[model samples]
Target chain A: MLKIDNLHATAGDKEILKGISLTVNAGEVHAIMGPNGSGKSTLAQIIAGHPGYVVTAGSVTYEGKDLLAMPAEERAQAGVFLAFQYPVEIPGVTNAYFFRSAYNEVRKANGKEELDPIEFLDLMEKKLKLVEMDEAMLHRSVNAGFSGGEKKRNEILQMAVLEPKLAILDETDSGLDIDALRVVAGGVNALRRPDNATIVVTHYQRLLNYIVPDFVHVLAHGRIVKSGGKELALELEARGYDWVMEAA
Target chain B: MATATNATGEAYEQAFGALRAQGGPSWLPALRREAMDRFSALGFPTTRNEDWHFTSVTPIAERVFKVAPTRSGPATLSPADVAALVISDPDWHRLVFVNGRFEASLSAFAGLPADVRVTTLADALKESPEFVAEHLGKLASGEGQTFTAFNTAFAQDGVVIHVPGGEIVEAPVHIVHIADAQAAGAGIHPRLLVVAEALSRLTIIESFASTGSFGAPYLTNAVAEIEVGNGARVDHYKIQRESTDAFHVGTTQVRQGRDSMYHSFSYAAGAAISRTNVYTQLAGENGETRLNGLYLIDGTQHADHQTFVEHLAPGCASRELYKGILDGSSHGVFNGKVYVDPVAQKTDGKQTNHALLLSEHARVDTKPQLEIFADDVKCTHGATVGRLDEDALFYMKSRGLGAENARALLTYAFAAEVLETIEVDALREGLEALAFARFTQSFGEQR
Candidate 1:
């Protein structure tokens, strides 16, 4: 579903992602594990078309189309979703309204009729149950004064509503407690299908316990150096990333 | 203080002479004489003056305007057009005026209660001369105001409302002033006087709008004097939507008695140049006052709001909030001052002005001043000038909204803060629809 070949990216003068290459097909989940400053988040951002990062070399193709050339909004309309690590707070814009706008935009791009407010609200109620969110949160401002767990869950709720083909979960379990992690992982597990794919980026192996990945790749110094089965996460958790760095 | 007679000043003098030649009441001539003398001495306000620093009245002073003629036969507008301009609800009393002249055929006051008086200034002069003589030039004295002096000198007709003591007026009173361009350089002065007796409650909505596009610029000089008695409550709202080629200058003076509450909301969106001066005096103890205003201007339009609040009694509270949105090369000005007297101990006062600029060439000048003479008073004032939040824009854009849609949403959100302050739900909803239409036109299509 997605392909990245020798992706070289930088923010300002510092090169973050250096000579990284990855490929993921449909019906598979890939876990990119790395230590701090290992360019795991940078790779996710580049795939979602963040304007701040400059790709110095290499290419990214999504569904046989060049994803790097498209604008951020166009990529979103083209079914690319990025669950942000730190969700931005937009005052005076209700979450329900924003979500409906995004959903309609994507639907329009796919040549589907836009849903009215009543129709959208009916659809939203079903999605709210998937994330264990209160209906009151829909009326509140977008991520304003939200708790850490709530923000992460709201991001997941957006993912469920949009139903993107290629979703990148960037540090989705960083600040979540054990109960929230279970619920979030359960929501992600329910969304897995035969025609869609997810790339989970995390620093800890504890998340893989709930949403088990098919392949665990260890990213070190801006490159994925090790790829193995689900048992690799347990070994790394027992031995630590220092052992993987030495082996790489 | 600067008595420099320019061409505009000389033309006003000529107009005053003509009014004297065609006289009215015995007392009006003397008031006109005194006002014209004051207007001649002070002349038009210039940018050099501290009060008129940001707003220059040069455009008004350079033009020569003749006095708006009296009803030259019947009005040209149909009943449907008049109905279209009115607020949709019919539970209120409406006093309609065309070209600054009261139209008895167009007005409707079917359900007004007895003992409450709502009539035109011209009718009250003959019907209740003694009452009109007592309150005509009493509350809003043309002391240092040139435009108020001009209005006092030339005002022929307007709205005069009086509510008796211990009465709760359930229906709102709307006074609609429609300025039609029948002739070029026609200047009209419309005066309003509202007196609420002790323990009374009322709401007054005054709107100034133009009928059609005027080939030549006309002037609408309006003044409203409101007196709130002891323990009374009054809500005064003014909406100004004139023609693009028109110029409007209005002054509103309010006096609140002991334990009285007075609120004023001014929404300005039209006209080439418009200035509204609002002054409130908290004269008695435990008085409460709120002054709120919102202005939206684009193209080369200019809108200015000047406000002054005086806390003269102890235990009085006053708060003021004014917001402006300027686009293109439009200009906006806000000058607000809050003064606490020496005897006004334990007084609370706060003032804030915020401006959002949509274009680089748009300009806003805001000045909030606080003068506290009592040691026990709490007074604070602040002013801010800024553009849209960039982080908020990027956050919206990342959600699949196009650039124009994202900007339009943020701009609506910015102006909605001020709209939320309105108390009347119906009025608020109507204004919101108007605001939505305005922003959609100002920005592009909505997503």
Candidate 2:
């Protein structure tokens, strides 16, 4: 579903991702484990087309299209979703209203009919249960004054509603409590299918326990240093990234 | 204190003399001449003047031309257009003025309640002789105010609304001041008098807008006097959304009695140059007043707001909140002043003005002043002018919205806080619709 060859990206003259290459097909989950500032989040943001990062070299193809050439918003319309590590707060814009607009924006770009408020609200009702979110959160301004857990869950709720093909969970479990982590993991697990792929980007192995990945890749010094089965995460948790760095 | 007369100043003097020569009433023209002497004596306001610190009336001082006598053409009005200015209030009185002239045909004054007096200032000279004479030029004579004198000199014709003792205006009294664009050089001078007698309650909504796509240089000079008697309640709103090319200068002069409550809202969204000066005096003990204002300016338009609330008696309270949104190099200025006399003990007053600049070139200057001679008073003031929150913008853009759409949404929300301050439903909706249309047009698809 996605291909990256020799990905080298920098933000404001500082190199963050260097010649990193990866490929993921449908029905597969990839977990990228890295130490702090080891290009894990940078790779995720580049794949999702963050404007701040300049991909100085390399090529990226998502769903058979040249992803690097498309704008960030177009990539979003083309089914690329990035669950932020730090969700933004938009005052006076309700979550439901923003979600509905975003949903229709993507739908409209694909030559589909947009759902009205009633239809969208009905769709949200079904998805709200998937994320264990109530009706109260959707009515308030977008992410304004939301609890850390609530903001993360709200991001998950948006993912469930948008149904992106390749979802990038960029440290989605950082600020969530155990209950929220379970609910979020359950929500991600429920959305998995053979037709879509999920990329879990994190520094900890606890999330991998809940949403088990098919392949675990260790990223360090702006490159994916190692790739192995789920056992790789347990080994890294037991021995630490220094061991993996030496082994790679 | 300062003396300099340019071409505009000489024109003002000639115009002032011309108005006195065409005298219609006995006392009004005398008051006009007195206002002219006051204007000449004060000269045009300069930066040295404390109230004119943020706003420079130099542009207005340079323009000496006058608006045409009266519109000789047909004013456009559609069914949809009527919806923009009409209110369905049948219990109280209604008055409509087009180009500063009374429009009896467009007004609705049905089921007139007894003891309440309502009439045009022209007719009020004879109908309510005592009321007009007693309160013609009572307020609006500060140390240095040139525009106030200009407006008082041209107080040609307007409406006078008075609620008798212990009476209540069951329905809100609506007033619409329509400025015609096709007649550019033609000027409009109007005065509004609202009096709520002791123990009475009244609500007045005064609006200023344009009729059609008018290019004529229009000058709207207006002064509204509001008198709140002991234990009375007065609610007032000043809405200005006229032609983008028109110039508007208005003053709301008010006096509060003992234990009275006066509330006011000002929405200035129209004209190339729009300035509103509000002066409130708490003359009686334990009286309270509130001033809420909102302004949205873009595309070279300028909106200036100045306010003064004076506490002459003890135990009075006042609070003010004025906000502005400037885009496309537009300029907005806000100046608020609160004065407490030596004897006004236990007085409480607070003022805040917050502004947002959508474009880098857009400008906003704010100044808040509090002068208290009394030792036992509480007074505070704050002013802020800034751009949209960058973090908030990033948050919206992350939701898949473009920069333009994100900006439009945030700017609309910023102005909505002040829009929510409007108490009238129809008025608030109209103002919001206008603000929304302008916001989207500049930053959204229309751009």
Candidate 3:
């Protein structure tokens, strides 16, 4: 469902993604692990169409369409979702209102009827339970003063509501406690389907225990240095990223 | 003494001549005489004056606006037309003024409480001369304020609301100042006097509107003098919705007594050139003052809001938040000052002015002044001018909202910070609708 070939991207004068290639099919969950500043998050941001990075020398194809050619909003409407590691805090805008606007926008783009307040509330209630979020969070400003774990849960709640075809979780496991990690991972595990895909990008191997990945890839110096089945994650966790870095 | 040139000077002289011809109350002539002398001395405040540095009244001065005919027979507008201009609150006691004169037919004074003395200023002067004489022009002085001086000198008819001591007015007093098109190229001075006695409570909604479409530009120079007595509470809201070609210069002066509360909100949504000055002084201990404003200007419109809050007594608090959203070639200016006097120990004051520019030609100039003379007082003021947050825009876009819709929503949210502070339900909803319409229209005009 997704393919990246020799993707070389730069942010300003510094190159972040150099000669990176990856592929993923439907129903697959892939984990991309790397040390800090190893381009793990950069790859995920580029896929989600963040404007800060320029794709210099490669193409990204999603279902035979040029994904990079679309704008960020268009990519979202096309069922590409990015759960930002640091969700922007927008004061004076309620979480429920923001979610409703976003949900209706995607619906309108797909030629679906928009849901009214009542219908949207019902959907939100259902999704809130998936991530174990309190109903009070809906009335507060969007991510304003929310705890780190609550912010992560809110992102997963959005994912559940939008039901995107391809989801990228960038550093979703970072800064989460054990219980919050389980809640977030459990929601993702429940939403997985054979027709949908997910890419988990993290700096730790602990999240793989909750939402086990079909494959694991070690990213070093903006390139995938090692690729293997799920066991590779345990191997790296026992050792360290240094072994993979030296080998690459 | 300094004097204006050409048409501007002639307009003042014409107003003085008319005031002489029309006999007023016993004290009115002397007050008008003093004001005329002050106007002649001050002329018009130029940019050279620090207070008027960002806003110029040259456009208003250049055009000559004759005095609107007082008691212009009967208003030709129907009740439905009047209803459209008001907030349509059934319980609100309304005093409707047309072309600066009392429209007794449209006013609903009988609905007010028995203890409340709500009547037109003209009627109050003739009937209750003592009450009118004691409080009128006491809180709002025309000494240094150019527009207040002009308004006081030529004032005709406005609302005079006096709630006796210990009386609580449940329903808000609505004062509607409608400038009819018949008074084209005319100047209408509408004055309001609100006196809430000790332990009393009252709410006032003052609306300045134009009756016809843009054509000949008129001027509405208004002044509202509010006095909140000891332990009293007062909420005052002023809505300026004049014609696109019209000009408005308004002054709202409030003084709070011991343990009193004063809340004032001004929304400037119309007029080619609109300047609103809000000044408040905490005269007693434990008084609370809140001054909030929102100005949305588009096209070639210009809106200026100058606010001054003085902390005279100890244990007083004041908060001010003014937000402006400018689109097209519009310009906005906000100058807010919070003064903590030497005797105002333990005074807590905060002031913030934020402006959002939607287009390249749109501009805003904001200055927040904090003068702290008390050693133990806490005062802070900040001013920020910028376009919309790009990161916020992208975040919204990635959530599937269109770029235009996202930008419009952000702009609306920025204005809501001030709009939401309004305690009146009907007024808040009405302003929200007006703001929404303005944003939609302007955002659609953008590329």
Number of the top-ranking candidate, with DockQ as the measure: 3
RMSD of each: 3.2, 4.0, 1.7
Please give the C-alpha DockQ score of model 1.
0.50
User: lDDT scores for all predictions?
Assistant: 0.86, 0.82, 0.88
Q: DockQ for each of the predicted structures, in order? A: 0.50, 0.30, 0.72
Q: Write the residue-wise lDDT of candidate 2 on B4-100 in tens digits.
A: 3666667767777776776565776677778877877887678778766666666655566474465455645543464465433444456777777
What CAPRI grade goes to candidate 1? medium
The candidates, ranked best first by lDDT, are 3, 1, 2
The DockQ-based order of candidates, best leading, equals: 3, 1, 2
Per-residue lDDT tens digits for candidate 1, residues B1-447, read: 455457667777877887788656688788889988887887788888899988878878777778887777667876578767644356768888888888878778867779899899988887887787888778777888888988898898898888999888888888888887673478889999999999999999888777776778999999999999999999988989888788999999999999999999999998899999999999999999999988989999999999999999999999888989899899999999888899999999988899999999999988887888999988888889999877677667667777777787777777776777777777777777788778766667334
By summed lDDT, the worst window of 10 consecutive residues in model 2 chain A runs over: A88-97
Candidate 3 residue-wise lDDT, B1-447, digit = tens: 225785677767876887777776788788888887777677888878899888788887667678787554556877678889766587788888888877778878587778889988888888898888888878876888778888888887788888989999888888988887777888899999999999999999998887776468889999999999999999999999888888999998989999999999999988999999999999999999999999988889999999989999999999999898888899999999888999999999989889988889998988888888999988888888899888788778878888888888888888876898999998999888878777766778775
Residues A1-248, candidate 1, lDDT per residue (tens digit)? 89999999999999998888889998899999989999999898888777789999999999999999987778888888888888888766789889998889888978999999999999999999998999999998889899999999999999999888888899999999999999899889888999999999999999999989999999998889899988998998998899889988
Q: Model 2, range A138-222, lDDT digits (tens) per residue?
A: 8887888999999999989999988988899999999888999999999999999899999999999999999999999999999
Error of 1 at A76 (Å): 1.8
Per-structure clash totals for the candidates: 0, 8, 0
* Interface quality of candidate 2 as DockQ: 0.30
